[model samples]
Target chain A: MTKNILLSAKGLSKSFGGIKAVNNATIELKSGSITGLIGPNGAGKTTLFNLLANFYTPDRGEVIFASKPIHQLPTHKIARQGMVRTFQVARVLSRLSVLENMLLAPQKQTGENIIKVWLDRKTIKKEEKLNREKAMSILESVGLDSKAKDYAGALSGGQRKLLEIARTLMSDPKLILLDEPAAGVNPTLINQICDHIVNWNKAGISFLIIEHNMDVIMSLCDRIWVLAEGSNLADGTPEEIQNNPHVLEAYLGQ
Target chain B: MLNFIINLSNNSGYIVSLTILTSVFAIFALGLNLQWGFSGLINFGHIAFMTIGAYTTVMLSLSGVPLIVAVIIGAGLAALLGFFIGISTLRLREDYLAIVTIGVSELVRLVANNEEWLTRGVQGVRRYQIPFVDWEPGILGKVIAIALLTGIAIFAQWQLLRGIKNQFKEYRSVQNKSYQPTKPIVCIIWGAIATIVILFIYINGIISLYNYHYQAGLMVLALLILALVYSGLEILVRSPWGRVIKAIREDEEIARALGKNVFFYKLQAFMLGGAIAGVAGSFYAWQLNAVYPTSFEPLQTFNAWIIVVVGGAGNNPGTILGAIIFWTYDAVTRFLLPQLGIDNARLSALRIMVIGLILMILVMWRPQGILGKKEELTLGK
Candidate 1:
C-alpha cells in the first residue's frame, strides 16, 4: 500500500539581502510519518520550515498541504488547516497561565468570537469546559497537569518544550513542524521527549522535526533530509545519511 | 438623612462636576487599557476618537437627531476612523502603529481647527442638547430611579462579596507558602469600609433624586455608564476573544501559529477601544455643555496614558482608581497651590511638574502599578 503525501514543498527558495537563505529546497512529508531535517548552522533549516509554514513567503515555490495549495495563505490560515509549527525557541505566552497557553491552541473556538462570547454564553461555556478538559488531559499525559494554573514562563526549559508540543496536540493538527525539540533539554528529558513524539506518531499525528541530535534524529525519524549552505545536500534513510560522504564533508569540513 | 443630603447637595455642584469629569476620563482610560494594556496596541491618538465622538454627537444633535442616537452614531464614527487607521497601519511594526496614531491624532485636531464651517473653527461647537436637562422626574420616575440605584448598590455589594471569596481562595492556595496574613486582612477591612461608603452614597443619591438637578442627574448617568463599561470590559478581558488579543500582545507569531487571525483581532481591539473612547467623548460634551477644539488637545491623550500606567495598564478597576487619584490631585492642588502664594501661570506649571514627580516615583517603586500583578508586566519585553 502506498502512503499519501500530507505536506509537499516544491522548489522553495528565499533570499535575504544578498544571501540565498533557502535555495530551492524541497521536502515531502508522508501521512503519519516521522521525518527529520538536519543541517549545519546557516544551512537555512529553520528558514525552510518558515517557508513551509508560510511564515515567510518564498521567492519562488509552491507548498501543498493536505492536497490544497497553501503558499499564498496567511500563516494563521495555514495553521487553521490542521498544520502548525513550533519555534526554534519555545515561544510560549509567558503572561498567560499554562492552561491558557494550551486553550489558545484549539482552532475555531466559539468563544473566540467577541459577539458570541456574550450572546452565545451557553455554547461558549460548554466549549470552554470541553477545551479545558482536553487541555488538562494532554497536560497530564505530559506530566504537566500540576502546573496548569502556573504561568508558562515559570516552566523549565524542557517543560516549555513539552508544553509547546502538548499545545499542538490540542489543535488537532495533522502535521506538526518542530524546529528543535531537544536543543536545551537534558539527556533524560530528551529521551522522554523522543518517547512522546513516537507515542504521538503512533497515535496518527505526522511530524517533521529539525534536530541536531543524531541519536534523536536516527532513532525517531523514518527518513532524513540533509542541507548544507542553504541547499539540499542529500536525502536517504538513517544508514544512508550516516554513510553519505557529501553530508560528512559538509559537517566535517573535509 | 434628607436634611444632610440637602446640605451636602446645596454645595454639590463643584463635586458633582468633578465626579462627572473623573467618570468620563475613567471611561476614556478604560478604552486605552483595552487597546494598550490588554491588547498591546499603542494607540497614542486615543483623543482623536473622543474628538470625533464629541463633534459628531454635538453636530448631529444640533441638526435635530435624538441625543441618544447621536451619541451612538458618534461612537460608530470613531470606530470607523479606527478601522481606516488600523487597516493602513496595523500590519506594520508596533512602533509604526504608534507613530501613525500620534500623527493621525494631530491630523484630526488640525482638521477640527481648520474646518470653519463644520466645526466653527477655533470658536468650537456649542448649544447642543444635554441629556436629562429637564429631568423633573415625577413621583413615578423618582421611585424608579431610587429602585435602580438600590439595585446597583445591591449588585455592588454582591461583587464585593465575590471578591472576598476569591481572596479567600487565593489565601488558601498560598497558605503553605509563607504568606503574609496581614495582606489579606487589610484588603478585607478596606472592602468593608468601601461597602459602607457605597451604601452612604446610595442613600445620598436617592435623597438627591427628590431634589433633582440636571448636573446631579448627569453625575448619576455618568457613573452608571462608567459602571456598565467597567463590567462589560471585565467580562471581555476574561473571554477567549480577549485571550486571543492577549496572545497577540505577547507574540503575534505565537498567536498566528495557534491559528488566530492576528490582524483581525488587533483591528477589532483598536476599533472597540475607539468606540469606547467615543462614548466617553459624548459624556464629556454633555458634562461641559459644549465642545471645543482646545478641549480635544493631545494633552488629553497623555492624561489617559498616565491613568492607565498609574492604575496598572492591564487592570480595569486600577484604571478607574488612577483617574480618581489623578483628578483628586489636580483638584486639591488647584486650591492648595494658590494658598501657597503662587501665581496662576507658575501654579499650573508647578502642578504638572508635581504630577510628573509622582509618576516617576510610582513607576520606580511599583512598576506594575497599584493593582497590576508583577508576573503580568509586559514592559521591557
Candidate 2:
C-alpha cells in the first residue's frame, strides 16, 4: 500500500469532435522508473501524452501525480509541480538566445521580480551565477554549451531537441513526458540521448518516452505499453512485447 | 547679416517648439512601442490615454489642485483607463481587439466633447496653469535651467551608481526587433532628438533663461519626448527582456510554456503604453494652452496605428521617425499643397486617404512594414 506510485492514470477517456482519441487507457509508473509508450501512426500515442500533460484533460478518468489529482490543472501548473512535457515536433522559444531558453525553465524564477532585482542585488547575482552554471553544465552534457549564446532558432532540429531536454532539467523535474525525443535525431545522437536518459533515470528522474523506434524502446524502457485505436493492445517486457500477437496485428501490423 | 541673425533668433522659437513637441509625441510613440512594438499587443485606441491625461491634468489643476499633483493625477487616470481597457479586451483575438480599442477610443472622444460641465464640451478647457515659470526667461533663466538639468543629471548618475535600472528600462514599453538587426534606428532618432534638445537649451538659454515658460518648456518638452523615444527604443531593443517580447509576438504558447505569464506581461505592456500616451496628451494640452475631448479623437489613435505600421511594427525608432515624417507631411501638405489650389479641409481627408493607401500597399507588398522583421509579423505557425 505504501509502494509510492509516482503517476497513475486510470480509465482515461478523451475524444476530439466525435472521434475517440483515447479510451480506457490505464497505466502506473513507479517512482524512479523508465517507462516507454509506443504505438504506430494514429495509435493515439501523442494524444495520450497531451492528456496526461494537461494539454487536453481527459473527458473521463483520474490522473494522480505524486498522490495529487491533476486532471483539472493546467499544463503550466503540472510543469510547476515538477512534471514537464516536451513536444513531438519540438517546441523551442526560437527567438531567444540558447542561454535565455535555458534560463526560462527554472520554475519560480527570481530574476523576473522587479522589487527583488532592484533591492537584493548581491543575492540575485549569486543565484543567477549558480543557475547559469547549472544550465551550462546541462548544455555541455548535451553538447550545446558551446552555442549557449547562439539564438535557439538557428540551431539544427536535433540540437533543438537536445536543448529542450537541457531546458527541462532546469526545473529539476520529477517526471518528463517526452513526445518523441529520437524522432528526427541522427542515429548516432539517438544512442547518446538514450544513454543520457538511462543515466538520468539511474539518478532517480522518471521518464515516459513515446518512441516509434522499436530498437530504442527495447533498449531503454523497463516496461513497454502498446496502444492501437485509442485502446490498450499489449504490455510486457521488450521480448514479450515484440512477440505479442495482438500488438503485431493491430499496432505493428506485422 | 543683421537680418540673418534676427531671423535665426525669431525662427528658433518655432523650430524649438516643433522639435520639443515632436519629442513629446515621440515619447507617446515609445509607449505605443512598448505595447505593440514589444509585446505584439495592438492598442488601436492609444490616443484615448493622451486625452485622459490632458483632460484630467487640466480639470484637476483648474479645480485648484497643485500643478504637479494634477499632472500625476492626469497620468494616473490615463493609466487606469489603459489598465481597464487592457483587461477587458486583451483576451480577445488581436484583430477583434484592434476594432474594439478603436471603438472605445472613439467613445472616449465623444464623451469628452459631450461632457460640457466637466470638459467644457465643445468650448474645451482653457486658461490652465503652466508648470515651472518661477522667473523671467533670458540670461538668468539659463542658470535655473542649468540647475534643474544638473539635478536630473546627478539623480540619473546616482541611481545608475546604485545599480538601479536607470530610467526604468525594465518598465519602459518595448517593441519587437529580435533577429531583424542589431542596430535599432531608435539610436539615430535619439541623436536627432538630442540635437533638437541642445538647440533648445542653446536658444532658450540666451533668448529667455529661467523663463521655462509653458510654450518654451512645451517646445523643449517635445524634444525631450523625442529623446525618450530614441533612448527608450534603443535600450529596449538591446535588452534581454526585449527579446522575450518579440518571442511572445512570434509565438504566444511558446512563451507561456517557458514560464512567461504571457497574459500578464501583455497587460503590463498595454497599461504602460497607455500611460505614455497620456503624457503625450498632457504635452499637447500644454502646447495649445487648452484641453478637450475633440483633440483626442479615434482618428488620432488610428493615425498612430498607421504611423506604427507604416514605419514598421517591430521598430520603435521607426514609429518616431514615422510620426515626424507623417506630421511634417501633414504640416507641409496643409500649408503648401493648398497653395496649388487644393482645398485646405480636403487636404486632411487626402492625408488619411494617402495613409490608407500606404497601409494597403505595405500589407500587400511588404506586410512587415519598412523595417519590421518578417518573423515578427508571422505571428505563429
User: Can you write out model 2's per-residue Cα lDDT over B159-193, one digit (the tens) per residue?
Assistant: 22332232134224222323434233443454456
Error at A247, model 2, angstroms: 1.6
TM-score, structure 2 vs. true: 0.83
Query: How does each model score on lDDT?
Result: 0.88, 0.72
My TM-score estimates for the predictions, one after another, are 0.96, 0.83
List the DockQ of the predictions in order: 0.60, 0.33
Strongest candidate by TM-score: 1
- The per-prediction tally of clashing pairs is 0, 19
Model 2 CA deviation exceeding 4 Å by range: A1-3, A114-129, B1-6, B133-141, B147-212, B219-244, B310-312, B315-381
Give model 2's docking category. acceptable
In model 1, the clashing pairs are: none
Candidate with top lDDT is 1
